[model samples]
Target: MVVEAKNTTSPHNMNQVDVNSDDRRDEQVPLLLQYWQAVSRYRIGIACIVLGTIALGIIVTLLMTPYYTATSRIEINRNQDKVTNVEGLEAEDVGQNLEFYQTQYALLEARSLADRVVRSENLATGDAFFQTFNVDPDENGIISGSDSRQSSEDRRRRFELAIRLLLDNVSISPVRGSSLVDVSFRSPDPQLSASIANAWVAQFVDSNLDRRFDSTIDARKFLEERLAQLRARLEDSERRLVRYADNKEIVTLSTTRDAEGSTVGGDTLISSNLAALNKALTDATADRIAAQAQADQNGLNKDAIENPAINGMRQKRAEIASEYAKILVQFEPEYPTAKALERQISDLDESIEKEELRMRTGALTRYSEALKRERNLQNQVAQLKSKFSGERQDTIQYNIFQREVDTNRQLYNGLLQRYKEIGVAGVGSNNIAVVDPALAPEQPSSPRILLNMALAMLMGLGLAGAYVVVSEQIDQTIKDPSDLKNRLNLAPLGSVPDMRKDDIISMLQDKKSVAWEAYISIQTSLSFLTSHGAPRSFLMTSTRPNEGKSTSAFALAAVLSSTNRKVLLIDGDMRNPSLHQMIDQKNVQGLSNYLSGDDDIDNLIQKMPDQGFWVMTAGPIPPNAAELLSSPRIKKLFDHLEEKFDCVIVDAPPVLGLADIPLLANAVEGVIYTIEAGGVKVRGIESALRRVRSSHATIFGAIITKVKSSGTGYGYGYDYQYSYGQQDPLPAPSA
Candidate 1:
């Protein structure tokens, strides 16, 4: 049967195949599992590194000195209490509380505060402070027994050192969403830690009070000087105001004062007089207008109409006139009774006219009196207005002096009040109160064993991962069967484990050995390498010699023969034949003799004793193995062997640095490439494979040989051992 295989020699096909293989691998093997597999290769080294790092951490932790921390908490008020209604020098803005608290926190750690603490505690005078921190006082010239000048200098240095140490060891932590702050101190001595913590709080509070008092002292002095100047200004302005008012004949009547008890404005006596007379003149003019309107009436006035006597007379005249008209109509023109009635009516008319005249005269007199009173009031108002206008002009200067006096008095009063407030505030009350005083801690705050170990473990793992990555990048050998497909873009047939200590030939004979089973699996894979069952005739080759190509060939042949088929194992390497040695046969005559035209192919082939397979050694080493393998005779030999044996496996020479394998590869059905696990680099294998493919040889698949059971999970426990003899140089072509 002709075994057909896909052409994988093209770069495109190779890359496509590699991609498909990688995709399938990615699907089958989880990414994390692949990483784990890679890491497992160096598991021992990683463990060692991790354990070593952890041990180092333990040792260092043990050697470290333990420190105790003590903390004191205090509430800091952003604003102080007001003793009086006077405003303080520093106004507090509600929005600036954050900045205010931040400033307070900064002050808690200030170097000045540290100096105060050191001095208040008298720490610089004693060696106990230095001893608590495990510092040598003599090293820094502190507490030096020297001359007076030197002693003073040493004491100064010691004082500064104490301040520096105090600042370095002190910590300030603010509580969130609160006005509370924590002052903490750390030291090797627990008692010292507590002492320093409490002392820091105490000193900071005292310093705050001192700053308040000092600030008030300056403010008080400034206010005192200002008050003296203002007092003199007040006296001078008051004198000027009084003298101006007197010169202008301006007498004050009423004044207005603001909420601050400062005079704002005042009315003079002339202005008051003018206002009252102007009111009287307006009333008199109204009265005169009413009287004049009554006097100007043409008929009887309202007074006459309302008079009862006038009304009675008008009624009697109406009766008398009626009686006279009746007498004239009845009698002659000169009748006595008619004349008498007319006379009576005339008399009543005279009386009514007189009464109306008297009322009209009275209205005229009242109008005259009202006009005279209005004229007098107008004259008086005009005179007062004239006087008030001149007084107003004069009062402008008086008011200017009055305003100066008012301003001076206001300032003097304000300053006097503020001065009083400062006197009381200068005896400052504490705005910062201690909530919790620090206590000496019984336990050290550091050198946690578990925490150190976990950190060490993580660091060790990081370093180990880096090392693995670098090693993987540097070493590009085929580590497992997956590399054959992933790196070389060739199908992996099977893996044979390393069994260098065992007898490979004896293991091949034993059916139950791991080496035997591995070959059986490889045989099964070879069967599926082509469309037909295992190829009728195939060749095995490697990138370099001793890559287990010969052993693989023999093993496959032996396994194939076990299926009740006549198999032939041919050693195609004429220059370095190893098959005869494996079978304990002499290399007297084989493929070299057949290819050299001896043509006794049957005699050249030898059957193994107690074994079903046959062996054909390279016979005598040929002077030109490449030239001999390239002949058409080798093809005829393989065709003849195929007819005689059911299967034929030619163990060809290595492809690299030799031309024999490519030449012989065409004579077989296909090429079964064998690669030693972790032996040759991927580049070398690719180069070798390329050379073989250059001859158009069909590469069926690849077999990973001597794979470590640990490195690749697919291989068996047994390892196959093989070696190569150095190739003899080809004799110069005969001339």
Candidate 2:
């Protein structure tokens, strides 16, 4: 049996081969190359899109209306007010606050400013600006003669409508880090654009100056009224203080220092008196202390006892004692003279004691008198302090009145100064000035022709690229041979370009053509499929009918016969045989008749004219074609044909859902699988291959039939070169 043994390698090994092949493909081929190839394939459609979009862009650019923009520059002074050299005048930097500059920009585009510009330009009557909005000249604009007599309400409405239109056309932007702003207006008329921009700047400056003047005037008037009120308040405060003091008899006195170095005024008169009485009480206390000390020392001090009465009594006692001593020395005893002397001395001693007692009593009396005087001074000091407390209450009210007077005076002075400064500032010139007036523009700002066309081309290419990618994603048809080898591991033997004809005879007859060249290459590849020489008996089949399987069979047989080899082309599809039609042979006595044992192989085979190939057409439609192909007798028939012919090519039926091809495949040395390019999906090829593989049939390789010639870079290139008179040597197809 020439058929190779079934693939004994495990499913795991086969899967690994597939996986490694996929990994190698991913590593070798870049994503960009794949995209480039796709773009190259579908470039015609993409070019159509780009050209169409560019044409549309050109038309739109021609139809668009042009607009001209005019701009005016103005400078704002943050310290404008400080330019004047007034003493109290200081400038405010409105630009220092974020919201301030934002507000200024807003004001530049304000409705009021717009209204002023409109009136100044007299754009409310029969102007292009108002007419663009379809506003009636009679109702919305103040026409010169007739409509001028419109009502006040009507005039105000027209003014408002014009202002809205002006604001819509105006734009304001501030220059960064500078006190400058750009005011721009866009209009169809260049002159109107410039005029409107200049008018807006002028109106903004006027409005700013008017606001400053009004604020100053209002401040002056308010200050005048405040100054009058403060003066009256000051006078009333002073008058109230004076009247209250007089009514309460609370006289204000000058502050003075007393002997104690403490401040003394009429406010402290009671306190001063109390201090004086305290000093007297201190003195009296000291006197009483000294007198008491003297009384305490009366028994111990000789000077204390030596008063006038005490000293005289002591002298009389001393004389009597001397006389008694003289009588004692003379008298015998109990004498009258001695007794009288002793009695006299005792009386003198009694009189001395009485004198000392009376002197001590006088010291006590002086001490008591000093204490009584100290008590009297303390009582007087307490009464004076009580009286001073009552007077302090009155002083509190007086202090309140004085503070009010001071506050009123200070406020009145501040207001008077501000009133003067504002009066000076109100006469100052406007700080905001136009730096550059708007001039009429020479060119339109919109509907750029070249730029629009460029953008449109870019957009068109983007859309077209997206369409190609999406179509490629949804389309499952095989585009080229590389996808088959990489995705399905099935290398195509050769690619047969679309023949543009239903008859295979025309393609076979036309040598040096793409279809003829493709099959020649296929025949060459068929020689290398087997290591010995070539596959002797191979089955030709496809995933479905009408995919060029029968045509390929006849062509391969013809090419094989050209190599001086006897070839036998058999139509194995008895159910729907097509080989007879391709070769213009009769099917009366063919494979079916031979298989049914009615006719011999020699009577069943037909010979082609001048072509060294034999054809065995399907004789009749059989009821069990698959069963007939599966019988042991089919193998006998193949073996007998192999001995007779150099190459036996069987045209088998489509493989999917049929038992015919797989049974035939099992007997042949190899199976030649054919798929239609851009016709069958990879899934269909895989399913048909699976069917052949299950029968243990060896797949020689695959062939992609009817590939589009453009961008395929397959056998079509060689045909093109040869047809154009180029004799380049083409390489043989690989196994």
- Indicate which candidate wins on lDDT: 1
Candidate 2 clashing pairs? none
Model 1, residue 307: C-alpha shift (Å):
12
List model 1 lDDT by residue over 1-735, tens digit each.
Answer: 221232333344344334444543553444565677668788988899899999999998899889899999999887665555555556668326677887888899899999888888988887788778877555754544333445676788778888888888889999998888999999999999999999999989889878877898899889989999999999998898888877777889999999978778877788788878888898999999989988999446677788899989988888888878888888974798877887888888888888888888899999999999999999998888888888878877887888898899889998898888888763546568999999999999877888999999999999899887887788889876777766777877777776552355676766766667778878877666544567788899999988889888888888899999899898888889988887777889998888888977789888886668888899999898888877788877877888888899899989989988777777787788999888899999999999988878778778888776556545222322211121432121111
What does each candidate score in C-alpha RMSD? 11.0, 15.1
**Residues 1-735, model 2: lDDT tens digits:** 444442332243334434433443453335666677678778999999999999999999999878789999998775565455553333454546777777788888778888778778887654466655445645525534345566777667767778877878888888888888988988777888898899889899889878877788777788899999999998998899789878877665455555533333344455566668878878988987887787778744544555666677677878878887777788854788888877888887787777667777887787788778878887887887787788778777766776676678778887887887787673556668789999999998777899999999998999899989997888787766556676677645666766643544564666665557778877766665555456788888998888888888888887888889999999999989887777666667688877777637898888897566888899888788877776788888988888898889999999888888878887777788888877778788888888888888777667887765554555345456434452553333221
Per-candidate TM vs. native? Answer: 0.65, 0.55
lDDT of 1: 0.80
In terms of TM-score, which candidate is strongest? 1
For candidate 1, the 10 contiguous residues with the lowest summed lDDT are: 726-735
